[model samples]
Target: MKKFKKLFAATVISLAMLVAAGCGDQPTNEDQGDADNGGGDEVVTETPGDVGDAEITLEFWNGFTGPDGEDIAKIIAEFNNLHEGEIAIRTQTMPWDNFYDQYRTVVTAGEAPDIAIMHLDSIAGYARYDLLTPLDDLAADIGLEDDDFIPEVWDAGVYEGHRYGIPLDVHPLTLFYNVDLLEAAGYSEPPTTYDELVEMSLAVQEATDGDAWGIAMPVFWPSNMIFYSSLMSHGGDSVSEDGLTPLYNTEIGYEALQKMVDLVYEHEVSPSDVQADGEVTLFRQGNSAFHINGIWMIAGFEQQDGLNFAAAPVPTFGDQEAVWAGSHNFVLPKQNDEDPERLEASMKFIQFVSENSLQWAKAGQVPATYSVLESDEFKALEHQYNASQQNFVFPPSTPFYGDAWGPTGPAVDEAMLGQLTPQEALERAAREGEENARDAAEN
Candidate 1:
């Protein structure tokens, strides 16, 4: 595995260097003189070839730096073996923060990879910059339709009127419960509603005699995600349709955030000062009965010795059921010069991964492809299947959506820390978010 990764990394570096050199020397359309006059150097461009006629190597970039990386590597290996001399995919893995920071720089320099794995929320941002190629025609060529994917994830790939990504997998927030703790509290199953959640949590606290709590509510990390789900459940929208206005500061928003705050303060079911990942630690250590986190944590939780845990969809905490989810998407970066054969190969690779995403599910994600999700093999995975069935709420699709929602985390943190009331925190967040959105739009 290490050898394969090293080889792929070297190939990526070599390809990138060659591309940079080509970009630096290539003449622009205006710089080219009359072709027949022989006044300028002859420009030779590679014409589109049949996919199987010549071996094509594609550069792929992604930020799957955890256990998930290993799973994807396996899938890539399978694809490479199947294509053998026809096509090869070389990958370069980096941290997500670095991926986001460096992609635009590389794309602007005309040295972007042939393929990239993007997050659903990030598709619009890159599309807005014209850094991504529209995938609608390519998708149709490969027989990939919207009906083949989860509706929310499929729609997330579209920016303006064009599709820039192909749905891969969805990872949603779920309820993780320690089986022993729940049983000790006289509960045989996880809670399905807000009242039961609170009731069970309090009972667990009483049973544990304060040594273990009912829940541990963190003030950071997933707190923001939980808030989003709650906001949706309360029938609140994160932003206006135009994506320029913050809409999560109304009465519904207050009810959403206040409910989370109450878990720590009023109900006393959770600790007041749990920091980021504190809830996870508490659940793993059997110090808490319930922990709300993303399904991505399943692999790590399964590795803990002597820990008995199970997962379920997050219980409804408001007027409706909703869960925060995000997806990984396959995207094609806009190239300085496009090659049809390479593009065709890249699409084929994407289709293979999407179809075989059950392997991805083993890495603790819900396959976004409808056929994969409905397969008996996938349905057998209780946790992932259950989480996939939730009414998922995705981030708004807009180039400036990130900026529009930037203040939400700190706002939720303030409320959780009791430094400000839910109403006060959301008001401040909405005011700042709107300003940020306006500034980003202008830029």
Candidate 2:
């Protein structure tokens, strides 16, 4: 039942301290291109209230433009109906591409919304800019103690020892296999070990006569996550414990990247130069037998016309088990005019959302609350349950964690595309990360 201690002021420290202190990675929230709703939309209630007609209208904003966005809208509707006229929330939903730009512009213009959704990784940058408010008081008021949320997720929202956000859900990378395809390949279950995964991939390739791939590998966002996951599984890390040195280019890193390269070239189970969308399409079209993607794909995949699929945890590929994960969090924007009532209402909304997070789970996320995760309802979600309870790994808690990917991402992309060797890619990424760390340390 630990509480977040308030910071006297926003702290700005070197990236080394940020990393050493355990700040998480920068999540790449992709645009699913579901709708182009760019402006604020108000959600109205249907039922009567328990808080009477002492009404409070709050503005909420989020970048949930995927299938998850629909779920969020539905949750907002339900919350409104339950609260009735007492609390009305006006919501603005948009794609992730411009979400931060619009949020920062509004906050800078002194028209900040009462509350907004944010990625845990981006909290440090926002807090550094003094664009977010510390939520320690509101968290306490709503009884959101440390034990209420997953430790990794809870700590991710803290920057320089001040809590700035409340996590809603964690999206982790998971394995999705086409049931029919697996059976066709003479396998009753998805691969549980790295060797087993490779064997299955090879079998699928042979069975399909090279017409179908054993797996799909994206060269962009998914690539970075998979590489990091692999690195972690090998008992290696991206940066040193002190956060001053890049470690991914070491022998262990080479091993991890080599494994990825082997999947494409050495084993010939994956397609080369496949973009993210192409990889997803291959899986959806039944051309790929297995896919490693975020849990967010569950809702969409379940709706595909004739695809029969099952989910599993990302297998233990190396000495350790690990999978890359990120979270969506609720944050309060910095405001020129502070209204205690509005803040209180916002906290209540967050608490209500946490309590009813099963609805959010319906959008293919791992609930942040242990209570929800341990529920029979959540356990019924096969993929999410396993991923949440298994070796889910978050990026190192650091402001520089996100920026480190700038170089590492490209290096991995090159290796996947066969433009560089695995060792070359790891070495390059390490050099780039070291330069980034050096710059941050000096400044």
Candidate 3:
């Protein structure tokens, strides 16, 4: 152990000296063009650091404050212990609601952490504002090739032509069913079709004598994601090919949304006006036999005593199969005073996390890497592996996605509450999307 520590120390010192020597050529902010992208032709040379030589400490910020946060913290602790004097990570956990605001404020003030975990959909926005470093070269050095990851997840890191993020895991919305309830309803398996889902839901209600409903409808924020996924399952898309206009106003979209409304109002198998958390809570309390939520809820549900739940891909509501999904990515915040050593350390940590992502999968996220997903260890994870292989529909690449996403829940809620017809609700949602697009284009 002493010999290993000495060698690791030597490696750290050698790399530090090399970086110090190269710093003389790094450009000052005044002369730096597009400073946010690590301006100037600063060359970086990577030297593999020996284990147990963690001398450099990198700050990391993430919004994983739930049960997953403990898993992430444990992983980081392992990384620190393994690298000892070569690399150390200092992490700050925060609630996701305030994370972006804090990140933006710090980034604008040049106080950004060396690394941050961000949602894949939000990458384009930060990249557009030059707030993140393009990882093409660094990624190559870390051996993060496209072959290692799912094509869709790997491609999600790209903005325009440059890659800005490295995906960590995928969390897709899937169907969660109460196993006992399904059996009581005479369903040997979960529903595979919309009609089957409705029928089973109705049966569940009848079997329980109104003690529990079929499903709890989500009517808040990302409830739109479910609606959009349903629309796409029917061969409908919410955005135009150019991503500058909304296409959910079409007849196909209306039919898709109408199906959701009928589940609540017509079939009466689902409760309307329930918020996102309320849906999960209802399912947890055994008030609903089926729930549509992200894979992240798996760990929590597994802990619910007597819940007897299982997960499956969201049923095919239309001619195609699609489900709302998103990925978490590790990104380096663009820094004007870029240091090669710190950058290299950051990438090394990310690579370490990616390589040992089975620990992450245990937290209920689908590993972003194909090999990890196919591993015996991951395959044992049950529903996540199957759900990850399904057709996942992500938000279109756009800097203004948040703006457009905001209007969908209200519109979906309106339709579910009978305040407007499915057609009118879709039209309102489309108008909001178009207005957001116009604003984004103008700005």
Candidate 4:
């Protein structure tokens, strides 16, 4: 079949890349002899290195499908060209939709990529299934320090005291407002707190005469981070410190969810027509005045038109501020007990990528490195403009973490649509959430 041929060609190209990749480490003197080993028509690293006698070949994979992919590919190419004979990396791009299936098949079948990219939420899922290799010992061997990254981002990879991955980026919720829309609504400033947000929503709604919803964000059973901001903003904790049981049924959680629901039902600012109108759609269409999202949306928004907007860290609902965040981490897949030479190459690639993360941020995600995070280049990224703004906290990492997301999101949504009272929604959500968590933990 055509599909089979395409896969075979890709694999062959990958093998050729592997052969040339190792030559990059063999020193320029040895490259001549190394070239005789296979087809020489392969892509090489961008920079040349004196890796004459050492070689590490690591197979890397990711679902970059966005602008980030282009930038990452360039980085990988440069690493190959520079470190010839020392390290050879074979990189593959997978579509985001079928990424998990492809990932699991390779990992379980003993053909796993040397290293791959994963989201904070997903690491827990894969680690639970034993498809990932722990980076603890390797991390120690290479002096890979987690302290260099934000505590929340780094900690996302630490489940059960054994790190399964290394955090690469932090994507927290931020408020992007259309300046033109704000000006038309008679407001010059963006909301800074819960009260301010409500007022702004009311003003924007009144000014537009229901033509536009004041705000837009996903509120459903599958959404995790959206409610996290609201709950954390209002001093609510869905799970206990120990990740034992659901705790959002308490006053703070109840109050927080109640207020969000009221924003629609009580204030009449949110739409109530569709069964599933996710916020992402509304924001892209300019259907709302305020949008709650991460800076990673910057690249996409830059391509759109008729919008004047800026990003700010998501606001607080309490004395202390926080926003729901997650990370993309670089992880090594278990090689089915094959002590391949690529482990060193994997480390080289990872360290190089981490060190060069400032370039990575331009694609719309925060680099995990503290130095890059503090650097002027990254700080000045139009999307990451609120880097120094306080309390950009991510949610806690728990084995049942994914279950905690939508459990609270829709409770807030339904109550807002007046389909159910706030108290009723919270009560049902708490009961259902605890059951879900318990089921996951038990399984």
Candidate with the greatest TM-score versus the true structure: 1
lDDT of 4 by residue, 44-157 (tens): 222222334336666677666556666777777677778877777676765543455667767767889889886655565567667778888777777778778776567667
lDDT, candidates in the order shown: 0.74, 0.73, 0.72, 0.61
lDDT of 1 by residue, 16-46 (tens): 1012212111111111110111122221122
Q: Regarding TM-score, does 2 or 3 come out ahead?
A: 2
**Superposition error at 385 for model 4 (Å):** 2.8
- Over 4 Å off, model 3: 1-54, 273-276
Model 3 Cα lDDT, one tens digit per residue, 1-443: 00100000000000000121111111111111012112222222222223354578788887666667668877888888788776878887665545666677678678988999877666777787788999999999978889888667677688888999999987777789998999998888999889998999999999999999999887653456678778878887666544557666888988988988889988999887786478878899988989886787788888888798888888888977777677789999988789999999999999999999999998888898877888899988887776776676655456555444445667877887789998988788778767865666566
Off by over 4 Å in 2: 1-54, 240-245, 437-443
Error of 2 at 4 (Å): 21
Clashing pairs in 2: 22-397, 23-397, 23-398, 24-397
Cα TM-score of candidate 4: 0.80
lDDT value, residue 320 of candidate 4: 49
Candidate 2 TM-score to native: 0.87
Off by over 4 Å in 1: 1-54
Query: What TM-score do all the candidates reach, one by one?
Result: 0.87, 0.87, 0.86, 0.80
| Residue 115 error, candidate 4, Å | 0.3
Q: On TM-score, who's better, 1 or 2?
A: 1
Expressed as tens digits, the lDDT of each residue in 1-443 for candidate 2 is 12212111101112222332232222243222222122233332222223345389888888765567667877777778788778977787655656766777788789998989977656776787688999887899879988878887787788878899899987877899988888888999888878898899888888888888999888765676778778878887666643446667878888888788888888888888797579889999999998887788888788888999988878776877677777778999999989998999999889989999998997788898989988999988786676565566654445565445446777878988989988898787777777776665554
Candidate 3 local distance difference test against the native: 0.72
